[model samples]
Target chain A: MIFGLVFWLLVIYFVARGFSSRRRRGYRWLQRELPSWEQKNIINAEQGDAILSLYKLKRIEPRRKMDMVKVLTLIGAIFVGVGVIFFVASNWQRIPAPIKTILIMSVTIFTLYMGYLFSYQKEGFVYLGKSLLLLASLFWGGTIALIGQIYNIPTSQNWFIMLLWAFPIVPIAIFFDNAYVHILASALFLIWNFLYTVNNSVANYYYPIIIFLFMLPTARKLLISRRINIIGLLVASLYCCFYKYEWLSLLVSVGLLIYYLIQREEFVYLYASSLSFIFWTITFFTVRKIHPNFYFFIPIEIILYLTYKDKIRENLIMCLVGLLVWLNLSIYSFCLAFGYKFNVINFIVMQSLAGMVIYIIGIISKNREYVFSEIYKVFGYLVTFVCTYLLSFQAMIELRAQVGLNNVYLAVCSFLIGIMALLVTNEARKGYFENKAVRLELFALASALLVNLILLASPSVLTCTLAANAVLVIFAIINIFLGVELKMSSIFTAGTVIFALFIITRYIDVGWKLKEKSLFFIVGGLIISSLGIFLEKQRRKVIERMKQNE
Target chain B: MNKKIIFFFIAVLWVIVVAAMIISKQSILRKGKAVLLETLPVDPRDLLRGDYVILRYKISTLDLDQVKSEKPYYKTGEVIYVRLEPRDKFWEATAVEVKRSADSGIYIRGKVGYCYRKELGVIYGIESYFVPEGEGREIERNIRREKSSVNVEAVVDSKGNALIKKVYIDKNS
Candidate 1:
């Protein structure tokens, strides 16, 4: 009931907000622009006058009024449909089987008839008709359930029945051009497919084949949105993952990538496809234990770079990052596959070598305007930071015993990397590099190195962990102060998130002694509250200073 | 006008399909022979089907000796016909066959749930008996307290498919 109330409230709020905002904006635009258009001779004086008079004559346009009516009718239809379902469920056993069947059939026919009648009679009632049709579809599903119960059909048969019911909706959705119906049909088919696969305990190789043969054609004919297609494909991919169908998942991911690449203008699809492709590739590797090959990504990156040559700078940076990740993974895979005794020292050395090479390339690329060198520079800095962290971690682990030559070597390498990063930042500030992001990257790298040094100096694991966390907390505080000084909201938000992470780690690390836990929480709460107040005050001061300067 | 007529025809067809499903089931129940099987109770709730107890019977698990099938092996999900004979208070499996026998006395169709060595687990479609909301727990409690078993009155058609008629919970308790 609470959930229903909340859902209805949200619906009402959004509808009211949408209509009011649209109307207000429409009127405001006409008022502000009509006179200017007339003066600019974009519109004639007569046309302008006619437009203004037409706007004033109608309080709301006939079309908009009809939209309002349709919205209300749709809402009413949904409520009635739900009421009918509840009425049937509550009084199900009381009714005779024949009577129950007849009643459900009657209701289904009545709603479907009314839906058609409303749709045929007037354009304004189309939404009302669509709502009724949706309800009718739901009633059809309910009828299947009713029959299943009446016949005491096996639970496994339910999916097949649903599949049959959903089959008709595809035609309905396409013929009517109703997105809601399309969504409903897609969801039903996916659900039936999922249940059918699970209940039968069968491998779902047929799912993709069915989708490609039937669903894809229907989706194309219906002109269903990419969102629905993406969802269906993702669900299919999930099933493939469950069955360990690596090739199928790879195909789906590659298909999605190609689909998005063809429409590379839409960033949403690009990002979504990238994420899904990465996820599928990682999962496929983990499941199949395939030897990682950087060569596979090279052709794809080259294709992307060539295809998106107009946006060379951004695409090049993306390709570079992809290549770097590929290189790292390939190295790891090679070490594993060759059965090399891969120690931390070797890992750090490889990473540092790659980082330095990339940093040099970035420094050279900085002179060119073909791409943003900041991406490569930041990537290099990140690689160095990771290598330093690993070395320091290993050194800390070995600190309990006598420090070996390997540990000493790791520490020296980390210190030298940190110095290199600092020198690079100094060079960047001297106008050799124009990217401010590179400076920020170096600052972060310097902080990481400082923390790593602290960890290396600590004797015990507990002390090292605690000291590292404390340094992070201190870094967050420094970041917060710096953000306030510069009045940068992103920096402030980052600091706040890092501070929260520190608190969470502390909570997890500390033992669950009641007194200690309580004290810790209480102290933490007080400190956070105090810091919040102080930040708010600083924010106000910063705003005042900006206002004065303006 | 043409669209409305088509929609009306489709709607009528849908109604007929639904009606036919129920009518066919009801016809079988009316024409089939009735038998009572003692039920072993287990409570479960379905979201759409309301509260219910999963009913298990003595015939659910068939011993290799009781099964009179010519087939050497039975895999899961394969349907087998079990011929029941009235014994004591309820019917027990007299014979099991892969196909329906022509001289059927009282047969119940079941799917092979799993096979473990010599024992084969069978599941009848009429395993769940739905009750009103909040009544499943009460029925479970009643069955537990009475120490008397619930007997399900079922009707089996010529096809060996059984439909549950009613559940009598401890009439003598």
Candidate 2:
């Protein structure tokens, strides 16, 4: 406890000190260097103008019309081929390290030269050259490092340290005006970090920073380029979110957002900035371990409130961003709640509650989109519930320690849970006349009943209740399909309730099997088959009815 | 005002972010310092919460003659300097070093030391410890856990070369 206390104090002190006005030594150095850099930029601007004039003169001179397709193909082939070679080399032990190094270096030099030559041309060939260079670097560097690990020279740590240095070649390529190299570098850097993250090593943090820096030059160029800045920014934003460096990443994004705001000189920044602030405020509280649950509503509420304001289109963007953040937070919460084996109940309850709250908030706030947003969560909960029900009886029998003395009660409860799931599904569907959600619920309801019915009719079944449940389950499944074809969410929901009866029937049956029930099996099977055929006919009728209306 | 200026600012911001990202990547330090208000005397016990001596930092450089006869100054508060090192291959500090001292002081129980940086002058501490004390071991456990903060006291000198005087436990922030 003393150790924990002391540790936090040190953190508070250093962080506080860092935020203080005492200007970090590095910051002081940066301040001193900025003036000189400013002067250099002025020089470069003048020089660049002269170069542009020369470039115009050169443009009038004879020049080759580059065959971009051939160049791009060659570059693509090199990259893909490198992947194959690396894949092979990773598995093979006999390849000499020096030979592999030479092979990689040869391709590296060629690709770099090609990239430099194409830098000022159309950007298509530039991407190819850059990608090839990055791939070559990975293969050469990774192979040598792996071989060193095998030989145990300079230690594994040294090899890792070396790779860290080698990995920056992608960004260097980008810095030199080859965006393709940047892309290649970013992808490799992302993959490398992902591998380490899966290994749960602390060193994985470097991956995000690498990709962030790697893509900066490219992203900067995009702000001026007429083509697809949004897509580029979105990708970078995703990378930032993925790597858990959203703070600074978001700050850099805001700078871009500010530029966009100024260009349009619109109030969109108000919406964007508001959404950013509210989302982060909630994130901030949650991260600090203070009143996490209360703050979760802040973003949703602000978004809904903003909808009633003027500039509906800007508000819509804010609403969408807010909704996305809420969902993101919910997913994180769900993982935290249900990620552990012991938290199964907590997971289900929390997700259900979260979904229901989102619905309630949407209704109260009069934000239709917020209500519509919860379809996936509702479907997720119901599908998972029904699947669990399908396996419940067997699960109980297999994991006896969990079932205990309340086996019959547990079985009945599983059935009830399935029924409760239908209630959630109905509420979800009723909230949105969304065809997608209704159809999905139909799939879940039908699949669950079908599985239950199979468990009953199979000859080697252990219990009579299982067999009886199976019959009811089959009927329920047919009914659901019919409802789905009719596009009636309510009717489909009712079918799910009927499946719940299979659970209830199991509870009332005192004996494990209904005595002398062999005849019932044959009759039940025949009836089920006939009912399925009838439902198929009904499905055809519904489709025909819909077509006639159209 | 113009596209060029906008582009230039963007470049500058990117570079700034890159630099910040690099420096921020410096892993947080897990060790903290605290002062012992009173001297604590302890016995060696194998099962005293996993074999560590509970340390109270006495005056850093004790006048062995002054406190030699009285209560062994066991309960008198001493300043303890906690040494933490960067995690190497074995998750142990490969090159162990003192972080920062709270202050420089002369006394058996209040003196602290072991301050060194790769490129900085050492700062001495007000208190130091004779350990197998439980506190030192707890500090070890903390550094391993990568705890967000550790407690260190500010020992200000006349020259204002303030170092972390000692490592101490504080219940409240």
- List fnat per candidate, in order: 0.31, 0.00
Off by over 4 Å in 2: A1-107, A118-167, A172-180, A195-207, A213-531, A539-550, B1-173
**lDDT string, candidate 1, A441-537, tens digits:** 4455455555555544554666555545555665577556656555666556556755665655454445334567778778767866776777567
Q: How far off is each candidate at the interface, as Cα RMSD in Å?
A: 2.7, 18.6
How many pairs in model 1 have backbone atoms within 3 A of each other, for residues 3 or more apart or on separate chains, i.e. clashes?
0
Candidate 2: tens digits of C-alpha lDDT, residues A1-550: 1232232234324433533334345444544454455477844545544553442211122346987775775567565655644443333435663464445445544544454445434465655544554444444444443333222222213324244424545444445654444444444444444444432223244443543344542555443221232333334334443344446444534544454445433333344444454335334434432223444465446445544433233344344334434443444444445442222322222333333333333332332443333333333333334333434454333333342222222243355456546655655666653555444444544444344334323424355235434545654675577565766654565566666555443443432365657755665557556656665676567656656765
Q: How many steric clashes between backbone atoms does each model show?
A: 0, 60
Write down the lDDT of every candidate, Cα atoms only. 0.61, 0.39
Candidate 1 deviant stretches above 4 angstroms: A1-66, A91-94, A121-124, A155-157, A203-229, A247-272, A282-440, A446-489, A492-518, A533-550, B1-5, B12-37, B59-124, B132-137, B153-170
